[model samples]
Target: MKRSELLTRIVITIFSLGVVALPLALWAQTPLIHARIAEGGGWNPDVIQAKVGEPLYLKFTSDDVMHGFAVGQMDMQPVDIEPGKVSETTLTFNKPGIYTFFCTRWCGLNHWRMRGTLEVTGSETNPPEPASPPLYVTLDLNLDAPHLAEVVPTEKASARRGAELLRQLNNLPTYQSPDYYRLRSSVQVFQDLSGSGLTDSQRWDVVAGIWQSNTTPEGFAEGKELYAQNCAACHGEFGGGDGVFADDLAAAGTASMQTMNGDMAMSMQTPANFSDPQRMLGASPALLQGKILRGGMGTGMPMWGSIFTHEQIWNLIAYMYSFQFDYPR
Candidate 1:
């Protein structure tokens, strides 16, 4: 062959190879993140950097038991990370913010502590506006305060009976408002109904009906599933604060109390007992929502603000109140 022709053939071959090799190089560069229980150091290299509108590839594997990987405030479902195997996912962020990535599985008592930050940086055509403060914050609620109800119902408040009573009452539009339901506790509602000439038991039933009206069957189901998946390990299936890790948490708290160094000591309080009518009834939906969003501050509860959406958080709060009221399943 002529020298020119030979050179042309070599150039074509090199171009073909470059096209194929580039993708492989990029794929190989995707980092592998290790997942382990919080006791075992949680996620390795927890802070990940990414660009908005760019695809970020990640590979994950568990060092101990099975765990789940998910990004908060994103619409994707969690990908399971199994021991001795790898799970891969590619995510593209549209907005620029510090997003949280966490384990969805209840791996251990510190499962909620298994969290990391994903720093997504880039300019957006329409940047998101700042969010207003949550209702609890706006209301200046002291979430740590003991908010036990002063009055206890004679019997389990029945939503069906309450619904019947609501039909007889007039000029009580506030009782039907979602805002009222979100801010006022059942005890407050019971007190409000005192002038309606209803017995304390009847007032309790009315409160239950009001709660049922604010939520739907679908919302309850979603809340139930979320609670079982994320909360049942520490809060119990029956809302009695006797979950698998309840005793472990109590023991951890006791051990911390004995430590002389306050800063180093952990606050491992027992999970809230939802079965306690006074406590649950006294807590407004907004209070419960705030607690779920912010988590228990140093109380062994993990912050869920990034993990769950606003509607999902409200749904969870509705289901929580169900433990006190006899709402239809």
Candidate 2:
């Protein structure tokens, strides 16, 4: 081969190698975030800063166990970061606000604690309208107070049975209104139906039918999935409050109390038992919505207002009521 031709071929090979290496060099400069259990420092440099309308590149690697990364209230697929392996994601925001990013995988009892903040700064092109307060806030609900049902049903109510009886009843009262149903407890509705000449059991069945009517099959499926992914760890798969993390939560509370003295010690209570007829029947959908959005006062329940959308919360509330009422599947 001629010397000039050989020299030109060598230069071409060198240029090809530089093109490949340049991208890796830039990627290496991107910040590498580390993930671990909440007990093990959670996310290092948990707070991130970026400007709106600019792509934010992120790199993640798990320090201890497998972990999944996702931003709350944002539409993005979760990226799993296996132990000692790296995963990457890109994000862009159009609005300026504090967004939450959390670990999707349940690592331990404090898995929900594995949350970080992303602060985006820029002017909004189309600002959102001011929001109205939730119904619980508007009605001044005291969530911590006991809400007990005055009347308990002798048997589990069925929505299917109620539908049959409802067709025969002449006067369909105002209690059947969806507006009234959202704000009042089941017991209240049952009592309101007394003037209709129906038996106590029939009244209970009517309430079940009303509750089932408020939700659709699609919404039910969505709620079930949300509960399984987010609430099952602490609230149990069936909402009996005997989940895998329930004992750990109680133990953590006890340990916290032991380390302190007097009322300053946190009083973390057991997760709510949705299967309890009395407990659930006494609560309104609005009240439950507040609890979900604001979380428990000291019950180790994390606030999900930022994580779940309004519709998602309502769907979850409807699905929870299914535990108390026997609805036609």
Off by over 4 Å in 2: 1-25, 168-178
Query: Whole-model lDDT, candidate 2?
Result: 0.88
What is the C-alpha local distance difference test score of each model?
0.89, 0.88
Give one digit per residue, the lDDT tens place, for model 1 in 1-329: 99999999999999999899987888788778999999999999899999999989899989999999999878897999999999999999989999999998889888989999999999876969889899999999988789999998978999999888888785667888888899998999899888989988988999999998898899988899989998989889989999999999999887787783556533779999999999999999989888888888778877899988899998888888888889865
Query: After superposing candidate 1, which stretches have Cα over 4 Å from the reference?
Result: 1-19, 261-266
Which candidate has the top score in lDDT?
Answer: 1
Instruction: Tell me the lDDT of model 1 at 56.
Output: 93
Task: List TM-score per model, in order.
Answer: 0.92, 0.89
lDDT of 2 by residue, 13-72 (tens): 999989998877878898899999999999987999989898898999999998899988
What is residue 227's positional error in candidate 2, in angstroms? 0.7
